[model samples]
Target: MLIAHIPGALLGLLIGNIIDRNLAIKSWADLRTRLPVRAQPQLNAEQVLFMLLGHLAKSTGRVSAAHIQSARAEMQRLQLSAAAQKRAIAAFTQGKDCALTDLRSALRSHYAADKAEQLLTAGWRIAYAQGLATAKQRRILQRCADWLNYPAASFSRLEAQLMPTRLRPNSAGNELEAALQLLGVTRSTSLAQVKQAYRRKVSVHHPDKLMGAGAPPAQLRAATEKTRALHQAYALVRKHLQG
Candidate 1:
């Protein structure tokens, strides 16, 4: 009887141990499921720029051919690789689909001053892609600029400075008009005012100055083009005024 009782006791103890082990394993699995997952990485500045560009492109009811061309031009300017270009296109599409709240959330992270300025500049370029920005486009750009912590005054200045100059059939008049627009002056403006505007534009857009301010290489290249345009504009405008 004692021997029988011993075997039964041992069997019961073994079953209890097995049940405890199974419970322990189940608890661990449940805890794992409840634990927080690591989030995906955030978008970088270039991606964000492209996204904003797409967003601005679609602001005026629908995206136009000019907007597509402008976005392609930006992709070329950035010299994006095939993979990067694909990613940019995807981001642009996402931007077109996303709400303004999503854009605000995406831009919530802080960027360096120069970087912020560069992004804002890109946004302005896209906004003015259709020769002139529509009211909706301007409003969208203003909101984006505010989100980027870019100054409202600076945004207005950029709009004034970067607006595309329209060319007519007259070659000489076209050149003169473009030059004047680039300098932010008019044909009747005094020589002194033109000179002052030229100086101000040069000071703001000089490549060396931008580089010193920690602007990226792309911005420096753009600054170089801008500085050259300013010089040429000043030369033509100066000659026209003096002559």
Candidate 2:
């Protein structure tokens, strides 16, 4: 009887150990999930917009009068009052000379996904305001898009919208080149190169991936569209290569 009781006691101890270990694992996971989010300093939308405008202007090598005027127009459209306009202007001036870190922080803290989208659009308008975008403007715009966390395909689509084209939207011929540009490759690009670029894009915009990276719900739709566009671009490239 004592021998039988000893085995039963050992079984009870084993069960207790298992329960304790499971509870500990759960507690650690909860602690990790509940880890506090670092608060970003609050920033004014108008000020951030102009600062970004300033940063882009410098990207093209000169903050021209036209550039400044375009920013002023955006300010007016936003209905900023005289005092607010001055503040925005001040931010723009300061931002022009500020380091890249400041610009990036402002973007991360001040703008949500939709606002970031609008800012990208505003950039094209500003660039196109003086006619066709220069090579420098295009290059700088791409860099700005990167800093703003805008996907390559989304950047291409937005930039294409402002460009003059006789072909209707969704025309295969038009999309072929745009698709190449979106993938950050050219016509002469190898299939391997295209695939690599496509995978990089997918990693950046996948929903589970973005959510894990703390992407907001508003941006999840953007991520979805980016992923779709990437698929389209890759499909076009693969078909072209096969043919």
Candidate 3:
């Protein structure tokens, strides 16, 4: 094959451009990966709560007044107004009639992972609101967590926090487990990874961002507890690293 060689400068420019293009693409990808987890803008928030609460309540096979009340508490937690509450009630009624499989499909397709996690957390509160979660409800919650593709450890952490009755007080093992889970990191994670997780979680739940997005006053209030929890968890992680 007879090769017509390009000028050295032209070849150098072509290689440089290729490298620049690759770096740009990589930087864009990194930027996207670093973006904070956020709610689903397109999904209706009240309806999502209704669907999640309804599905969770029904998962126990018999929805109790307590379960219904817990759902209401979620509305209270979200600070829904009277009209919004009525709409949520209607959605909850619809959710009660839904099959678990159908709700799972809807949740997975309609919301971002973070939004889905928020909805599922609401479900957990309802399930545990009676002071303990039933075996069936726990099973259903675990399955739903799997469907959401959340880390099992993270789910365990939330589960533990909600059901402190199940844990012995001041057990470092339990506390450490809970802390790692809250930070969304495994025990094997490095300190840098722990810090990164802490920052990411804080960014996602920042008061200004949620308030600016029209999150309810109650929800903002609830975020204070979450923030405190994050700080405690980070402290535990830091202690473990220093030790």
Q: Show model 1 residue runs off by greater than 4 Å.
A: 1-41, 110-112, 167-243
Cα deviation at 10, candidate 1, in Å, is 32
Compose the digit string of candidate 3's lDDT tens values, residues 126-166: 88766567787788778778888878898888887766454
Candidate lDDT (C-alpha), each = 0.80, 0.78, 0.79
Of the candidates shown, which would achieve the greatest TM-score relative to the real structure?
Answer: 1
Assess the local accuracy of residue 237 in candidate 3 as a C-alpha lDDT between 0 and 100: 91
Predicted candidate 2, C-alpha RMSD: 26.4
Candidate order, TM-score descending:
1, 3, 2
The residue-by-residue lDDT of candidate 1 on 1-243, one tens digit each, is 765667877978777679657765356677576679889678876677788888888877788888888888889989999999998988888788777667676676644456667777777788777767788778877787777778888888888777775522345778998899999889999999999999998998899887767989899999999999999899999999899
lDDT of 2 by residue, 14-52 (tens): 776896577664566775666788886566877777776
Clashes of each: 0, 0, 0
For residue 157, what is the lDDT in candidate 2? 93
Off by over 4 Å in 3: 1-43, 164-243
In terms of lDDT, the best-performing candidate is: 1
Measured with C-alpha atoms, the lDDT of residue 61 in candidate 3 is 76
TM-score each candidate. 0.52, 0.46, 0.47
